[model samples]
Target: MDETTTAGPAPATTVGPAPVGPAPAGTAPVGPAPAGTAVAAESGGWLELLADDCSPGDIQRLRAALLAGADDATRRRVESEAQLAETIRARLADRGRDARELRVRDDLVRRLASLRDSAGLLQEVVAQSRFLLGVDVAYIMLPTADGGRLRIDIVDGSLGDTLQGVVLRDGEGLGGEVMRSGRPLWSESYLDDGRLRRVRSVDSIAVSEHLGGILGVPLRFGRSTLGVLLAADRRPRRFSDHEVELLAGLAAHAAVALRNAQLFEENQRAVADLRQSNEALKRTDELRRRAGELREQLTAEVLRGGGIPEVGRAVARAVGLPVQVLGADGARLDAGPGTDDIDVVAVTGSAPERWLSGQEPASRTAIGRDHLAVVPIRMRDGCAGCLVAVSDVRIGDETVRLLEIGAMTAALVVATERSVAEAELRTRGAFVTALLAGDGDDAELRRRAVAADIDIDAIGVVVVLDNAGQDERAVAAAATRIAAELHGWVAQHADRFVVLARQHDVASVRARIAALGDGDLPAAGGIAPAAGGVAAVRTAHEAARQTAAVLLALKLPGAVATAAEVGPYRSLFSHAGRDDIAAFVEAALGPVLAYDRARGRDLATTLEAFLGQSQHHARTCEQLCIHPNTLYQRLERIGELLGTGWREPGRTLQLQLALHLRGLAQTLAPDVGRRGNTP
Candidate 1:
């Protein structure tokens, strides 16, 4: 309340506590007792005065006399009794206050739910603040448009009219301070308080109103303070801690209720405007009848758990035109019955979204003596899709409006479906994550799998996908899609995306995963055969992740393979000596040698020439004294026989090094190079 204007000099005010004043007239031991009065009270003479229900003054005098003459033990007993009595009184008072506060909060919640508009809610909050505290005035200060000042929005109590619509400038009053600090502040004799900065215009109003005691609490909604809820008194009175608490609680409730009511009003206004526009556009009886029928059918479909298919049919029937529902990605979700004749070429080629650039809710394009219109299906998440309508002639505004109604219905159904799908996905993801992490005992794992409707025993393959510079959301999306397709679940244990699939063929599973990208793996993956219980699953998950890392380390970014496929090379990086190197080279070269021996082919010589010639077909051909065509055919045959993985740079490097070892062995030891297939 900014009422600081005063015409004359203000009355002197006591700032903190009640001022000391002359004592009230009373019988202060008018007649003096005998000299032994203080001493005689020790034996029980003073106690008899209490049996007569003595006056307050007489009891005070008697009590003082006993305490003055009492020994140390007696004084201690008296003090303890006084302390216990004070504690009891405080506790009882607290109980009453707590009960009152609970009742007020409950009432506020109920009132908020019942409030239909912002003004009514604000008015109720202010009134409750004043009545609950029995203060002289209560009001809320809301920030102005420019936010440089606050205006008194609503007030209650007889003194409130003086404050309504008063503008409080920045740094002028306690209201602004409370708002800025987001904490409650109170002052006795606010007009005379020296600690607070005062503006002449606001202070003058305070003086004129004779406002004294004031308390302000920030009206907070979420992290922001919308305004200040303040209570002021006409007398220089000190507000208690309990009173401050009560006002603050009310302010919190008011903030939430005000915001809710604001949103509600905005929605109501929008709906009303839409309804009015619809009525104005209602031109003929037949059209009105059809629109009404469409509304009912669409509403019933949504209410009865319908989806795009149901919604599409109703709109098509009402408009006597074909309708198609497209998903967010422009994929066909569903088409109405007899919608085979829809202009697929026109609709697919045209961007329906571009047509929505103007003020119209929907737009259309000509289709060779026919028309196709689309209304965007806006759901809570975003634009979920569009409703495409085809007509024998140009589309009309009324038909477009009907399509919008259908779009709205379709959005609701799609949103509900999406929500359910998302919830299921979360449940599945969590289950798979727990399963992979071995979070629970065997029984618990089985129970979780059963609840998620998953068959634990059907699982045969575990694959881990590498993020490896992929968008996290995109990686997750791919994992979820593949997991669903495979009748399994995806879990992200740290950065690796693990998919537990039902298929047992690791190679076939890798093939499916490869299709997710263009012709290679969507992500570098490690595939392992899954079996056993928690321990086996955990071991396989670790192995799969290890394999994926090895693939990445080998510079095979878009490849999926098992750990054993690269185990020999992996050993080359570990604690392996000459024997290990010899064994690896033989292992790497033996396949080609054996195939050549069996088929009488030159695959081994071709691979040796290719590697020795730095994989140049012309150079290898010239070195081998063969034609380029022959070199190519031999290289292809070598690739098939050895499965060399020559395209991978790391694999090629390993083969090159192994070829060097073979050459050295031929020079140093005559029989070493002939161990697999002799010349």
Candidate 2:
């Protein structure tokens, strides 16, 4: 068995004293040893020479001189002590080397425990491996993906990349054998080792690296082998069993480190994934919470009978973007807080057809410098309108859902409004129609009119709309809206619109309605003089109808001809009004003449009866033996036939003078003018 343990075999201890040559020059001068001084070898110079530290040559020379004179027994004892001293010196040297090797191995183990990842751990293992075993180079080979071969994973103290990514197959080299057997294998001279089946590529690499000796051990964990850990030298050398054991121990540590590194990486990845999932859950929860709150808010709006404006405001507050609502016709019905800053007209024009008819599903469409997101306001009939959100940036999918909820509520509100509006129009339209037909009792009719938001006491007179032959339904809708704004009511009667306006002046009421919403209003209308009572309202309706016919006959479309603006001389008027005395008569009597031609009854007679009696209705009714309503209707017809200017004081004088001239011309006979009698 080997007594000394270090990386290599220790020098063997010599059994005898070293041969003593001529005295070294530094030795103390020695007289030729006094031959006759025969000191005992056992006690005399030997003990003193041993006690005092002296050169081996001086000590040996002294023993030789003394022993020459002493017995042979003394000489033998001196040789025995010298041999023991030489053995002790060899053992001391080996003890120092062992101490150093142990320190290096301990440091490698400490560093291996500190590694954190597989790649870094493998690199540190190979580097420390070279130092611990005192080899020229070190490397580690891990099994390839298929485990059919081992590829060099890491290398330390290498001169080039010749062996990098190099593979060792089974039965190909010493590294391959270690991988197959899962055991330690080494050789004193790698090139000469017939035990290893060398491959051409590995052999060339080995020669290029100047490698002669090699040692490798399998990195084993439990029962399975991971790879090979190898150390090599550039010159031939014998690797002792102790060196082999040390390398195997390191390989064991490397295997454990590799496994630990893999587990550590997996744990880190798991933690990162968990953190990301947690953040996503938090975001999802936040969005759900916001959606719930907005839904409740919008539901409250619908339940409370809130309309589009209210719904728009609630959604705007939630989404921080402008919102607007439009009717099925794309008219602006209501706008929210931020809508004033947006181009409402542009938004309406660019809107998708789905807003009205829901032809397609909702999505985002880009408008100039803005984006529009719409949700159809679905109704029982079809899509009634749309709820729109305008933003400079794109709206997210979550916010789109919130807007959809708002649109749903808006649909309910709009549907309710439409139902109520239709019912109201029916009730009010019937009431106004009956009152104009002179059918209901005055007191009962007045009460019913009040219920329909019409103060019958405040109604002055009625105006009949010709509607310019436009759509009667559309015309009635516009007329009803105007009546509501004017605090009155509208009636649809036989393709003509009769509105009982509450205002005092017919011209003011006409202008007011034109301002209200006239896009669908008639271009022509006729007004009667201010009157009250159901009987008087009936006469007013006839007068308005006659004036509207006169306007139509005169080709005065878009003109509101009223009974208070014309004179009796309109029966003598002409086709065109120009700057002549004849033109003045033409402008004054044109509508009255047209009325007589169309109605086949002369309003010229009614004009003469009212204006000829100095605007006094009772005297005219007495002279004609007609009712007071008949006298009032004739005077009002004069105003309606001659449109606009004839009701003025100066205009009335011109009309009166014109009527007087026509009377004189009628009284004088054509024979009197032919006989040259100037009358």
Candidate 3:
């Protein structure tokens, strides 16, 4: 180092060979020595190897040369070149791999973005996975509700149709194993694979579809495995680890999409159900509100003292339907204008018998396309009537309930009205009784009668009803009808109904009484003469009672004996001292009366007829409808019964008066002659 360091610069040019040197006798000649030549040759080979295309083996050879004998410069050059080549190759490979991965990710993103809904999302996921994974078929198998099986949901690829809608139990197929384990699974040859339990149906489908290699990855959301995403190939081949990884990645994306779709569908169904429930509630509330309104209207009408017609109209307006009120006898009570054609009888008749029984109200749709709702108008005693409503369309349950409420209200109103009417009638009856009894002065009676709505100025008759063995209620009801017909007033008197009517109404009152017929013991009635003022009313009442008593005694059952019709008999009977009258009748007509009684003959009748004809034989015969000889013989018999001189003027006058008196006695008290006494 010391000697070299002191030297100046060495020549850069190469020296040419000089003179040939001779070799020593025993020593080898040192002409261009082989060791230096060999070193130069190795260095050149390394340089060429590094400069040209070379393999790992060539680079290794170059490295060996450097380690063996190459200079520092050659070694450094070879090391640098080798590192550069290695780096270039590695970078190129990485770039290519990255590009392929980027394409797959971009395709997946594009497909996911294209989906507008869950169904489309599922289909695209399966299709994209199938295409990217390069499998024969791809499908998604979602777990069933029970979590014991998987149903093929979306399928794609060449043989996708063959596997569509296939189902597999939890441990049945490759896909089922993946779902059960919540992990990925693969089978190169599924038919021969024993690791996964085989199902004949699933295997048959696989066989039919010519599927061999299969790879399944669990589709997971949160901690739960929702299903399996599967890829299958037609030919038997082992699935590369990279391929399985790629499929699992696709399956992960698919799981998220499928879960989102399921949630979306569930949300949509829930929203629809909620909407329907809201509508139903709204309708129910509306019906309740309407029914409440109707009930209020009906109650208001009833409280206002509305009658049947007014109530019917109010109900019709409230419910928008036609209404009918029927009496207990099934008669139409509301006979207002325009109601005659309503066929109320038909409505009532069509009502269910149970309603009439006063149990619960009922409603039905009638044959005439009308909805009929009927409710029994029940009172404390019984069902007094029924309220019916008819509508063009069927009503709701709420509306029917309202109708029932209205019926109850109407019934209460009717009962109240009846009670008021009865009270008024009682008051009127008491007034009439006091007046007939002559309990007050004429002026006081007249004033009281006016206040009672009795027409003192009008000529009125008194009618005495004999309601023997008949229901007092029926008699009272009948009297009411008579009063209505005669436009008069009726009052209860003892066990009879006494009616007061004007002279013109007397005949009508009598006719009405006749129409009522005899009740129980052959009902008898008597009419007093029409007269004005309260005094006359008292007299007429007495006269009517006497007449009724007379008719009853005479065995004239169901007879209406009037004062004017009975004539002189009423006048004579009114002079009662009935005992004296009976004595006089016995004295004058005793012999004839005795003869008639003993033989049950017409001796008394013949004597009266002979006197009635004024002693003319032919007229007497014609009056008695007998032959002259028969009349003569009957007259001789009467003379014998009456004793001699009975046909003389003085005797005939006494005998005629006695005959009239006898008839009067018979009418006044039919049992008088039998008892030989007066009543």
lDDT, each prediction:
0.70, 0.69, 0.68
Give the total clashing residue pairs for model 2.
8
Please give the lDDT score for candidate 1. 0.70
The deviation in Å at residue 347 for candidate 2 is: 19
- Regions of candidate 2 where Cα sits further than 4 Å from its true position: 1-86, 143-151, 161-176, 187-210, 236-238, 298-679
Q: Which stretches of candidate 3 lie over 4 Å from their true place?
A: 1-116, 146-148, 157-164, 266-289, 305-679
Tell me how candidate 2 scores on lDDT. Answer: 0.69
User: Which parts of model 1 are misplaced by more than 4 Å?
Assistant: 1-292, 339-362, 367-370, 463-477, 490-498, 505-528, 532-536, 543-679
lDDT string, candidate 2, 1-679, tens digits? 2111211233321111223233334443245533322342445544454344333433445656544665668667755654443344335445655676667667877887788878888988888777766778899998898979889979998889887888989767999999888889998899999999889888899899999789999999899898899999898977777778878988898898787777888999999999999987987798788878887998887788777898889988887778877766565668566677766457546445544555555666666777778777777766777777888787777677778777888887877886787687678767766776565699988888778876766668677777545765556656666666667667766557777777777777767755654432454667775567667777776667656545554456557767655433233232232124455555667678678889896776666666678777778788788898876676578677776777677877877765554553343223122221111
Worst 10 residues of 3 by lDDT: 12-21
148 Cα displacement, candidate 3 (Å): 4.2
Residue 143 alpha-carbon offset, candidate 1, angstroms: 58
Could you tell me every candidate's TM-score relative to the true structure?
Answer: 0.39, 0.41, 0.41
RMSD of each: 28.4, 21.0, 24.0
